[model samples]
Structures are given as structure tokens and as C-alpha cells.
Target: MSGLLFAALIVATPFLLQAVSPGDANWGKLSEISQAYGAVSVPLSAAALAGVVASLAYQARQTRIAQEDAHRSTHRELILLALASPALRPCWEPPFVPMTSAEWERIAFTNLIMSGWENAFRLGSLSDDQLRLTLRGHFSGAPARMHWANARDSWIELVEHGTDRRARDFARITEECFQAAVLAGPGVQAADYFIPEPTNGAGGGGS
Candidate 1:
């Protein structure tokens, strides 16, 4: 709006000068001033336009990020809901060996946690460093370690054959963190897990 007003004022300046001074000498002077003003205003107008374009591009990127965050949040909510309801469990719970009902629920719960981390990593909510740190902390306990041991083969298969590169990277980083935690010993603190090396697109065997 300001740019348009500035352009309008520039356009009207010559006419205003002509109205105020009707003589030929004054008209010649007005023409000279108009030429000089046009030269200066052209660059200024271009700069204003560029600024508008840049602002619009920034807004678009922010909107995209907001949408992605909302989508990730919705996914997390659905996972939690599934965890709470047995009927919904089949929707997300992966196949596993036969176990007691209590054991199945525990395994399913752990799987949801892992899936949530994977989703966050895939959606850009968790940076590679954040994923490594969080996964190491999570797998520092026995339950998470047991869950990964049960699920490792399928996850490794996905990393080897899945079309999604982001998922593959997530699996590799997660496996590295899990392995680091294992090497740190069962009762070690999460911080005891060694800093992960660069991802090698491979998974480690379970103990």
C-alpha cells in the first residue's frame, strides 16, 4: 500500500507543477525535475517491490513449517489414543512373537514411543543430534532395549529396502544410539552412551 501511494505521488508531481506554473519556462523546469525524480524513484520502487517479494516468501516458508508441526502433533495424538484403547491397538501395533497380554501391551507401548520419535525425525521436528540424544536416553533402560531387540529385524529390513530416505536415516541413527546405550552397560546413565558416529545406513545386532 505504501509503495502504491509513493508511486501515485511520483506520477502526480509533474501535473501538480504544471497546474501551479503555466509559463513555458516553468514547464521546461518541471520536465527537468520530473526526469531527475524518475531516475531516483525507479530504483526506490524496485527496492520496495523486492522487499515485498522477500516478505511474502518468508511468510510462505513459515506457513509450511506451521502446517508440518500441526501434522506431527495430530499424528502423536492418534498414537496416544491408540495406546489407550485396545480396539485401536491393531491399527499401529507391529507384529511380534506370541507373548502374554501384559507383555503385548508393554511391547506395543514401547513401539508407539519409537514410532513417535521416527515420525518427529522424519517431519523435521527432531534434528539428527536431538534424535540421537533422545533415543540414547530412551534405550538406556531395559524395557526399551527389549522392545528394540524384538523389533530390530523388521526395522533393519525397512532401512535396507524402504523407499523413504528419511526413515532409513532415522532407523540408522536410532540403532546407533541403541547400540551405544547397550555398550554403556544396563544400569549406566543415558549420558554414558558414547556420542554417535556419522550414520552408516546399517543396523547393529541385538544382544
Candidate 2:
């Protein structure tokens, strides 16, 4: 509304001046000045209109971004609730793994963490390198590794069956992380496996 008013004011200012000035003064000079002002005002009005259009475009884009963010947040919350609730156990619980309640909880929580990471990646929160590094560090641990080992096949099947194509690359990334963890061998620290070399041109190394 303010933008429309401002544009209207820009377009109307010259006419208002023509109406308000002394009517007795030199009409010839006033006519020339009015013509000059009109020439300048034409461009000014065009620029104002362009600005209004650009502003509307920007606002629309922001609204879309907000809506997408809200949707992602709501979706993430629903998934978490379903995972934690006993009522939804049959929906996602791994049947192949015969484990204690505590172990199953850990596995489920690890899957939740991976899902969150994948969601962030899909939302452009994490770049390829960032996601890779994060997964490498995380999956280096035994619990995360165990969870991925049991869940990888199902995740890959989902990707292959046209379930959320966005997670397709994520499956590959996590698999790479799992493979790297295996190659690092037992008892190898995440820092040692994922960050083996010195950084920032420093010669110091990790134990």
C-alpha cells in the first residue's frame, strides 16, 4: 500500500505543482519548466514502478521460502514423534535386528539423526563437503555404524523405488562414510580417520 502511494505521489507531484503555483506569473517560462519536469518525472515514475515490481517479486520469494521452511519443520517434527512413539513401532522398527530395548532405542535415535542431516542437506543447509565431513565424523562411532549397517539396504530400496529422490545422493554419501569407517579399522579415532592430515598448512598431526 505504501509503495503504491509513493508511486502515485511521484506521478502526481508535477501536476500538483502546476496547479498550486501563482497563476499570474510568466506562463511561458512555467510551461517550459513544466515540460522539463515532465521529461524527468517520466523516468522517475518508470523507476518507481520498476522498484515496486522488484519489491513484490522479492516479497513473493521470501514468502515461498518461509512456507518451505515451515513445511520442513513440521515434517521433521512428525517423523520424530512417530519414531519415538510406541504406537508407530510397527511402521518403522527393524525386524531383522533382535536387540534389547536400549539398543533398539539407540539405533532408532541414530536413524533420526541421519534423517535430520539428510533433511538439512535437502534444504540447502549443508553443502556436499559439509555433509560428507559430518557423516564421516558421526559414522566413525560404533552406534552410528551399526545403525547404518542395518538400515542402508532399506534406505537404498526406498531411493530406488521413487521415494524422495533428494535422498538418493544422501544414501551414497552415508555409504561412503560407512566404507571409510570400515577401512579405518577398529579403534581408529574419528579425528584420525576423517581428519588424517594437518590443516591450514600446519605440520602437526593427530595421534
Candidate 3:
């Protein structure tokens, strides 16, 4: 309503000026200008309304994009934090996570080490690329499957029903990607791999 009124005022301003401006303003010319202004006002007002609508639409789009970027940024920060400390890796190995799971099984993890993986898995959006890398590149397959199977009930309780869809799918996708990586092994592109349904938490369990 305000926008329409402002536009109407702009269109009306010129006619008002010509009509009221002191003396000697030809009445004949004033009448002609009034007619012209009347003819153009509606189109000018419509254009103004369109500009307002377009600005609102643009602002809405930017707001959504900002939210998504913030989501991804949160995941990135958590990934960096999880990998920051050397104390988390006592025995040493390249590219921790999946291998860390094996290392953990061989010689159980202290609470500190366990915490690193916890932040890596739980802090950010699951679909985040870094999170996916931590899952598929570092921890997928038998290791992730085994861990998830053991923790399923606890995780379900944590997430409950209203949890974010990305986080929920993250749990399921990590397990699937892990199985796929195990099947593919070295040299095959993981993307070329197919995910197998979780198999009864089969094979064996490790610490």
C-alpha cells in the first residue's frame, strides 16, 4: 500500500506543480499536461509495483542462500576442529577416521580420541562434502557399519523424530558408503561402487 501511494504521488507531483505554480501559466497547456499525466500514471505506477516485487523476491532468494552457506560453514568448522589435535592420534596413521576405527579396535580408544570422531560425525550437516569425505574416505564400509550397528539405538534416541533430514540420512548413507568402499577396495572409484544393504551387522564386531 505504501509503495503504491508513493508511486501515485510521483505521478501526481508534476501535474500539481504546473497547476499551482504562480501566475501566467497557460490554462490551455495546463489542461493538456493533465490529460497526458492521467494517461501515463497507471503504467508508471504498475512499473513501480513490479520493481518492489522484484526487490522482495531477490531479498528472499539471498536469505535462503545465506542460510545454506552458513550450514555448510558450520560443518567445515567442525571438520577442522575434529582433525586439529595430535593427541587424538596416539599411534599415528595417515588420514585418520576409517583407519582410526581399526586402530581403535586394535587398541581401544580413550575418551579423548573417541571425542574427535564424535565431533567429526555429529557436529555438522551430514551431506556436507567434508563430512562425506570423513565417512567414505576415512571411515566407511565394515568399520562404519559395525559402529553404526552397535550405536543404532542410542543414535536413534539422540536424533528422535524432528531431527534434520540431512543428519538422519547421514547416518544411513555413511553405513552404505562404507559397505560400498569395502566392496570396491583399492584402485576402484568409490562412485562406481554400489551400496549393499546392511547385512545383519554380520561378519564380526570390534571394540
Q: How well is each residue in 82-192 modelled by candidate 2, as lDDT tens digits? A: 667867766665546676555566677777688778878876798889998998778667777777878889988888786555678888888987898888976343345
Inter-residue clash pairs, candidate 1: none
Model 1 TM-score? Answer: 0.52
List runs of model 3 lying over 4 Å from the truth. 1-29, 86-207
Give per-residue CA lDDT, model 1, range 36-138, as digits (tens). 9999999999999999999999999789769966986787787678667878867765556655556556666787778878878887999999988898778
lDDT of 3 by residue, 1-207 (tens): 999999999999878987879778787887899899998998999999999999999998679657856875675554445456545544333332344444344223222332344444554533356655665655433434444445555555655564465556555655565566667764333344577767776667787
Q: Which residue pairs collide in model 2, if any? A: none
Per-model TM values vs. the true structure: 0.52, 0.50, 0.34
- Locate the minimum summed-lDDT window of 10 residues in model 1: 187-196
How many clashes show up in model 3?
Answer: 5
How many times do residue backbones clash in model 1? 0
Better of 1 and 2 by TM-score: 1
